[model samples]
Target: MDWFTIKNIDAIDSPALVIYKDRVIENIQLLKGMVEGKVEQLRPHVKTNKIAEVCSMMLDGGITKFKCATIAEAEMLAMIKAPDVLLSYQPVGPKAKRLAALVEKYPATKFSTVIDNIHAAEYLSQVFSEKKLFINLFIDLNTGMNRTGIIPEHATQLFEAVQLLPSIKIIGLHAYDGQIRDTDLTLRKHNVDKAFSKVLILAATIEALSKEPLTIVAGGSPTFPVYADRKEVECSPGTFIFWDWGYKQTMPDEPFNYAALVITRVISIVDEHTITTDLGHKSVAAENPFPRVHFLNAPEATPISQSEEHLVAKVPDASLFKTGDVLYGVPVHICPTVALYERAIVIENNTAVQEWKVIARDRKITV
Candidate 1:
């Protein structure tokens, strides 16, 4: 089987992360078209591409609102001077203090976070109150994805309790429908409508009781398209920045292209049919099973095993590939895989142009 090789594969170090800038720009444009030019309705999550350059690219495309999963990600957005930012993850202990400090430091940027319980809200209020500051918050609604959100029934109570805290202002509701992964667009929309119906009801009830306007940020990569057109919902899709193999196969309807790839080299030939590459668990996300990476050149190759620094795959004819030959692979899960790398080589016009630092990969930022 023939494999696609990079133009300057010999120049790049082995197991390097590659980002196609032109494709990323194309993706941004496609998403913009998906939302019908209403860029404000798209609050892309920065957890996918943690690079500030990507954030700047989004800003250049008229996307200002951003969502992130860590303090460091939020800091990266703030550093970019993004008009609005949401720390999608709930913080505790020093993280909470650090969040308030982040808000204090970036006064020009609007900062918000998600909360499911009163304790987190109260703690954040106390932390911000000590600093004579306030932070915006959205109540995370558990719409079937029982990860980090309050159930719809308890949202009203949480909203009321949060209002009492002077330092934290209730902005809206956040519902992450990550579990809505039906490949069929119709079935996917059905699941999204059913799950988001609860969010809508809860939002209406909270708004009626509080007599305040509220924005709803709902859905992840899968359900973003379903909610993008809704008048009351702001879609926060992360993986759209760099489409991966998993979503490409699962959601074939999504027009986004793969903007990221892993460039690895064959290190050893185990036998006539078996070979090992430098791409490994540390290079790509191992959370998924074998075939974590889809080889663009050798589509028939089957991944057998993966270690910290190597991936073993059995090909129809391993002799076709020699040691030191570069291979391009699209990761099954690009988000976590991105966090594993410290930097990515930015490719433009099929040539390496620059490097983008994955600054937000770290868990903390010195605010």
Candidate 2:
């Protein structure tokens, strides 16, 4: 099957996730400029773009700190040997324990993790021994969202437990705006203010007890700027790394930096308002109810209503496509969606270019 191979991408496999390297660097530059001399420096989450090429782009923008979700991701960065890396997601299972052991293999790497509960802390601390690995302790504050953090009031108890473990150090807090969830600009601002105020209080308490106070590492793309402007917290914005429908509400203008896109060929023409494409649940993440096309000028093209094998797009503009014509799919949830794919078919100007492996896609559970 022939796919549009713009420039050097005429030979890659089909149904691939392609990243415009040039565009990614541009977006990285823009994102960095937003935080220029603002915070301690950016530690962009690598979960957004797992490819080495994208990580290199972030390095080009004076960013050295990286936040990774999986052990595979941390290992990949260790393989790349980037100076600074943080495993953003906690390694909480047998797989995670194996990853923590890898830390001894690479002594020069700076690794940190988050923990709110004692079971998770004890599990990770036991693996990293002899004060050899000092894991950063983040009091995952549940301002409201109860996903994976201790209550703001109970952070000290968790910290004291990790402190006793001898293998860990309570470095800081890993709070984010997802716990707030209020959409009102004023109300959201208020929520962020109160939430962070609690974070600062918690951080200061940790600082009072220890020689090195905790580094408050917290952020979500939606309220990043609010959190970024603060002095105590280090901004870790991943959605801004590759803007998608899931990230559009956060960035009104230049939403999709043209970084990530899915290439799928039109498989059927069901009717006037409906067109079937090969992209489906496996290609896009099911987290967001609706997915939209960045270029279609309408959401119905892929409209978050998606099933497993087929995406029935309500396309009224029938003239723009044919049976074999191709278009890219822009996912609402870029992270899990990208994780679902095996590799990204890197392209430039609509051609199949290079194959970038999703090296850290499956490091789901880290003990």
Reference-based TM-score of each model:
0.98, 0.86
Each prediction's whole-model lDDT (CA)? 0.89, 0.68
- Compose the digit string of candidate 2's lDDT tens values, residues 31-112: 6666665525567778877767677666666677877777778877776777777776766766556666667766677877
Q: What is candidate 2's TM-score against the reference?
A: 0.86
On residues 14-131, what C-alpha lDDT tens digit does candidate 1 reach at each position?
A: 7999998888999999999998989979999989999999999999999999999899999999988998999889888898989888988998899999899999998999999999
Top lDDT: which candidate number?
1
Residues forming the 10-long window of minimal summed lDDT in candidate 2: 1-10
For candidate 1, give the lDDT of residue 1: 23
